[model samples]
Target: MKAFCEEYNIKGGIWNDSNFRAILEATMYLPVTDKDYRKWLNFFFENCSYNQLLFNRIQLNEGTENKMFSDRDLVVQRLEAKLLRYTDAKECETEYCLKLTSVFERLDLLFNNSWKKDVLDLITRLPHEQYNQDEINKKLSFIYSNEDCDDVLVQIKELLGLYDFETAKSENKSEIRELLKYPHYYKVLVITGTTGSGKTFFVNRYIKYCLEKLKIRDISIIPYVFDISKVVSDSNLEQLLIHEMADLLGKSVQSLEDASKLLSYLPIKICFVIENIHLIIDEKSKWNSLISCINRFSRYEEFKWLLTINGYEYYALEDISNFLQRYCIEKNSLLNISKKRLAIFQHAVNMDELNKEWHVVETILQKTLSGRMSNTYVDVNKGITTPLEALYFRECIEGEEWVSSPSTYYEFIKKIFDWKANKLAECNSTTVQSTVLVIVDCVIEKLNCVIKDSELNKSDLSCLRSVQLLSSTITICKENFSVSYGFQQISYRIRVFPYWAAIMVKNRFRSKEFKVESITGYPAELKEWLIPCYIFYNAQNENALLSLFPALKKASLLEYALFCAQRDSSVFSKALYNFIIKNVDYIKSSKRCYSVFYFVFYCPLRISQKFKLFTSIAGKVKEFNLLNLYSRVFKSVVHTSKKLKQLKKNMLELAPCDVLDINYINGYETGEVFMHLSNNEEKSFDIVINDIIAYIREHESILEIIKNGNNSSFFDFFIRKCMENYLKSKKKI
Candidate 1:
């Protein structure tokens, strides 16, 4: 055992203790005489703690120290008698009976007739020992005898199942009882909001307040925070309440059901605060069922139900309005002034956080009151003038100023009454439509011009133009429209397909596949140009494309070449030729477009070798087609295709005016022209090579790159040659 521990690198003296016990148990359980077993037991007893030895002491009442053992001996005797009766029934096999008897004998020695002896005796006496009957009986007897046995068993079972009890308690458990003090007045208090509005946080805080501040003695009165989100089907509301209660209390489900069954008899007062009641509303006929349950419990003065949801209007409870009215009347709960009830038009508005600007709020209130007054023709000189009366009176007074310093609440009330009386005199006067159309029309016209001049791509400009057009058309139609109808119409249009399309074009480029020829005069070879042009059209408009046409054209050629090179060498060459051929007529018509063409041919020559090989050939073919078509327009034109063919024909035609050696060509005039063409072609190839290098560097593992036999060798050789050349140039031998 020592060697085994050393070989496994096991550390700590504690591990040795376990090993020693295991070895001792093995020796005792071996097929040996009782004397040998006793010897094995003695070895453990000699080294064991004094408490362990005392616990195992079998000689009951032999000394004062063995008093516990004496009591255990009596318990064991009772258990053994019970077991003997079961064994006499012949429910167990002889072998199992023998084994059980042996177990009891071992217990007699090990426990020294302690409290555990009875447990062992009960185990031995179980009827069908061969069929695990003894094990079941022992478990039953142990649970029945111990007061906290069920809880302990549950904890052990949870631990075996890997449930984290500490985490569950911290996350889910909450207690609420403080609200009971105002139970009659605040019975139907609701916490309503959208998801992530901190509804759960508020509920948890309320629960904590109840537990700590209220110091409620009756745990049963504590609120059971139920998550109705889990109630997918029409579950018994009573059963669900009990299940949630059990979860909160950390009690078994069966125990909870039993408690629930006896709830009517138990004098337990529970406040249920259900979250996500919308889920319950989804279950068939559950709304009325839940309402019935709440009403039944509400009859008990102590029972309270606090239901929360995102919106109240969504609830389809039968007689809900009447129920709410009755509850509010009975509970004396104050209903909050809803957004709609307050006649506030705006759902949300941005305001400077640091500054208090109540203009919008005041305006809304004033307008609502004035509209009501105009419609009713009521004399504002009422006995008790409300805030609504004051607003109406203010509107009627107009230029005439009425002033009064109301220091006290009563004085303030008197002034309001006086204002209402004045407004009543002028009540049946007139109603005016607020016309802010001229300013809106001017803004729309300015936006249209700005959008047009911004040179946005067609898509973006189209969207902006659509929005402007729609807004103008709607404004014209709504010249005498009601404010509410106008607002609704505008909102509806904004959400409609045409307006949505405009928004898509203005913001994101249209993702739908469409043919280039259908929209643009640009050829397919100029896809690179057309795409960005389209993006600009979607983002800005046509004005933007015209302004950046030269740069767009150059970019298109370069991009097209790079794409072709990457995909297929032959395809890239053909595409490059096609681009030049298609644009030959345009180039002939406009001399300014020649520079763009020159740049396209220049990029391939200056690019990296791998890209250069493909682009150079393509650029030559493209240049040949252009020069051949426009030979008459040039003074000293070089037909480079014939020279390039000749260079290819001659194995050692050094410095030939071919695509490969276009960069090396000399002369102030010819060199300038050649450089311009070579640069664009080289740039196109450079882009391709750079992209490949970036991809390889990012994704290919260094180890794999280095291990790649031929590629690695070639790269290494190139590096060495470059370094040698650099050294030679520096004269560093």
Candidate 2:
């Protein structure tokens, strides 16, 4: 083989694609394996007829019964003797011709017993057709199996989209039991759910079920499960999967036919599991390719199927029976799991001795936290939406310390950042740092949906995927900035802000950029952290480094930060206050000092976080009486937060009156407009318009609402009255 390879200029005696080495090594799928690949290659390259090669394989096994020519060598020896005996050529020809004619007459007897042409073709060719075993038997056998019962139950209700808890729970009686029982009633089981709903986790649960029920450990029921999302872009998804399967099984599978042959040789049942099959649905060719591949694999008795398609793809997959193999069409032939069944699965996999029904979350909190209760936020009445989040809720956000410091959210996110990195097979890569800057930029720009750039590689995209996986309200997939996913989403969605805010602030103080050169879509999904991104940007330049950081030019920027701090956890609030104090010189010198200080004092978290940003501001600028100014803003916030006014004498005597000691349940400045209206003596149209302008322009929150094309009813009423007053004035003129 080496000599022929060298003659043919074939290097290393191997094929071009190195991944095929495993394929070449597999004997179950093809006649030739790694051992014979070189020999076959050498034979094909040789300048000789195929007859010699064909004879070499079967030469030893052929013509054993015939006595005249028991082998090719024996026949050759007989012919040589005839030539050696003759001296004259004419006499030799005449004797040999008569003898050969008599030999041919005898050779005709062996023709009936020789090697069949089709059997040899099976070794060297891919056949166009396979099932032709006397038509009567094929039709009768199929009819017999089809008519065995009026109805056949192959799957649980969850898989069929019935999703009734009781119906799915009854799967233990026969449905689940029949999974490993041969022959399988049906092969394919497709499951679906929303993203982050623990669809993939079910595969593991099912595996455990099979192990516990079958009293076996080989896991051969469906050993090779693949996520089809990765390769859905490829046109030849079927062949790609075949190659993947061949590598896994160490078989040189050439095609679906080769895979079928491979399955035929395996002792245990083999099921092909393709996850996220709906990814290929939009591309008709790829979809047909995938469906055809499954049906082809279905020709073999052992080739069962397991498919998982998410709910987003179900619209395309509805009436999927139109595209499935004839054998898979039955009401109970599919298996899926609902939230209830997932709970059953959760119970089955709880793995905690503390509670048989639920212990994973209990174990997570106990192991990770120092002094957290076992069921801190583990609400048993309202069952799990997803076990991972439920476990996370128990460990991170549900505890007493969850809101006091954002460190828990940071730590949670850091694990996810690295978790995604590890899952992408790029563990501890610098991509995490780069993705932070990318995400921060999008948040600052208020961009929804990442503008996917060509440069963003797999690792960067995986980080974004991690962000999306972190929460449901990530803005990268959001359409309207005005729309909301509820207060909890707004409050906890941007747990990343404080962590990145600290990192960027620290980096800015050191005069550096945090791992950003070029990135595609920033983690735009978590766009609620717009305040932190702006704060980071405000501190970004070396020019500003000498000044100890730039002051935020827009008071709206400062107001937005305060809004986030007031509404959410104190992590971001504390970070922003610290950044401001560190750069107090910039704030003292800026034109918007009063505006910034007003919001800082108005937003309860600033004072509540125990930071004296105003004290530092007062030290730098002595022109304004900072204490008196802070007292006014503090009183306004406190007085406005109340439903009724307190007497000056009573309020003064009620507390020590320290500006920093004020407690306020700060929210949107809804009462600020009413306060302005009440303070003004004039109820005339001109005065009301001035009050409205002052209220909208001076107040950032009201201004932002109006700027965003949204108007409050009170603001709209003022505008309508102003119009009526202007027309009346015009008539008087």
Candidate 3:
């Protein structure tokens, strides 16, 4: 037996503590020697005793009992178990050494080797076997050498910047409790609200509630807020996810596969609160990965996902797409919270619970009232709390100075006009100033000039800067564009602001002293130039009669007045008639007389009323010889196929001479000669002749009277001449 033992333990003696310790140290290096194995065997053989009685009870059958005992197999199996235990211990020690080396390397990079020895000693004393590399790095990343933690804390407080007296929603409270108790019922919950309506604030409160009330693991809660505008521009999905995970887990997930594997085996429950999730619409690929991960890991029964979105955009998208609607929980929790907060603010302000704010509210109301502005501008109703409203209310209580002051009502009016003009300016970048000047000129000069692109230039547009010389101007309403209509074909329309003409009059000449008398009795050139300006100003101020007379350029003034006569004829018809009759030569020579006549003849007035006004004005005008005006009216009536009979009736009713007047007879003769020479079908005398023939046929009395009259030779000669001329003109054509 001694010789056999010597053969096994050749390098070292067995059955001693020194040999056992040597074997332990050698196992750190692999491939142990026979001497070491024998030493381990000898140590166990001496220390451990075998149960011989139990082993003897395991008797084999008669035939198998003759086989060898094979004690080598038994010894080898027993020794392998002890060797495995030693290998595991050594592996753990090796892993620690490797991690320690990595830590020192990182520390050197972070601190430049300063205080490395002290930190190393402190970490060595601490038990960090359970912490990961990411966890340790995260904790170390926060610790700075020369800075105090309070500085960071102050910055964090500023960034949070939430309002005091934040309203809490009852529905959110109950739902949060329900989630804590039974999270499996809801796979996703979405919180939505308007911009600046506190969607993010509400979600933050919910997260705080969960953290304070529930006992979720500190590492398992992840809160990610996304900015849609930035994400849509960049479209980088992996970087976004990696950064968010790194923020939460103190480490980045390299790939979805790695994340899936880690999340699959994690025993703790995880709650992911994602805000501004509408940004996911930017990257469909990232959305697929995130949604798939949620779906797959949701079966773990420990994962919960919560999302927030802008209800304004979300509901609009939901109408067209089911992607987000599938995850929508139909509840007005956001609105409820808003109402609650508004109530709190209202109560605080009304009851003086915050401070004395009644004086501030009263001051705002009084200033707006005195300034002739609407009082509803500052009215804070229920179910809405905006940042502006909050600022106003808070400042009122805190006694901060209000920005706007009193005694500048006209300045306020000017500010409004400036704001509107600036807003309209944004539509056409190159033509903003030109467009604004065109509108301003149209209102100021009272000219009905067509808005032609060819006529406008940069020089005309330079007035915009002069108009905005005041610093208080800002852009107001949105702009609108469409096609212009008229005889000219303008390609685009510059929408004249609603109440623009009225507002212009108010801004320039709205004072009570600038009455219509100032304009009506003005000089001829000035009155003619201010025609368009007076139109709107008079319309708004009920001074229609005061601007009716024309001192110079009667045709142009009459043309504009005739155009608007149908709208308000009380101010125009009498003056226009007197002007035309008094200045008959101007009406006859003016080329635009036909247009003016067309407007007046087609104006929406009773035929009898028109004839009365014309006769009254003509009789009153001094030296108003009716020959030239009557000739023009007669010639114009011949051209108007529709209103010819109406003019004839008006002439008969007003003259009292019944076609016997010498001026009318001469005018008729001239109209007949012109009609014969022209032979134009549009202006043909056939309709007129047929109508006259019909009138003669209907009134046989008139034909008999003419036949028996003493002036029958003149009538016969007129008839024969008219027939001959009509036949001759027809043959020539």
Candidate 3: lDDT over CA atoms? 0.37
Best lDDT among the predictions, by candidate number: 2
Q: What is the C-alpha lDDT of each candidate?
A: 0.33, 0.38, 0.37
Clashing pairs in 3: none
Model 1 residue 51 lDDT score: 60
Candidate 2 colliding pairs: 23-252, 155-332, 158-336, 159-335, 159-336, 438-522, 439-523, 475-525, 476-525
Per-residue lDDT of 470 in model 1: 16
Root-mean-square deviation of candidate 1: 31.6
For model 1, the local distance difference test gives 0.33
Residues 1-733 of candidate 1: C-alpha lDDT, one tens digit per residue: 4543332232122223223322333333322222343454465455543665443442222242233223323433333332232122212223423433443233222211112222222222323324554554445444334223224334323222222223333322121111111112223445543322334444554454334322322122335565564443334766676665554433354543354333322223345777645544434476667766665444333355656543321234323754453332221112112333321111111111101122322342344344331211112232212223234334444542121111111222334334433432332322210111222222233322111122222222222222222121122234464574443121111111112222223333343443232323333322322333343233223333333333435434333222222112233333444454445333322222333232333323212221223222334434444443222212122223223223222211112123322221211222233333434455443453354345336544432433563332322332343344435645963
Candidate 3: which stretches are off by over 4 Å? Answer: 1-188, 207-220, 229-235, 260-309, 319-325, 332-388, 396-733
Give the TM-scores of the predictions, in the order they appear: 0.24, 0.35, 0.25
Candidate 2 TM-score, C-alpha based: 0.35
Deviation in Å, model 3, residue 308 alpha carbon: 4.5
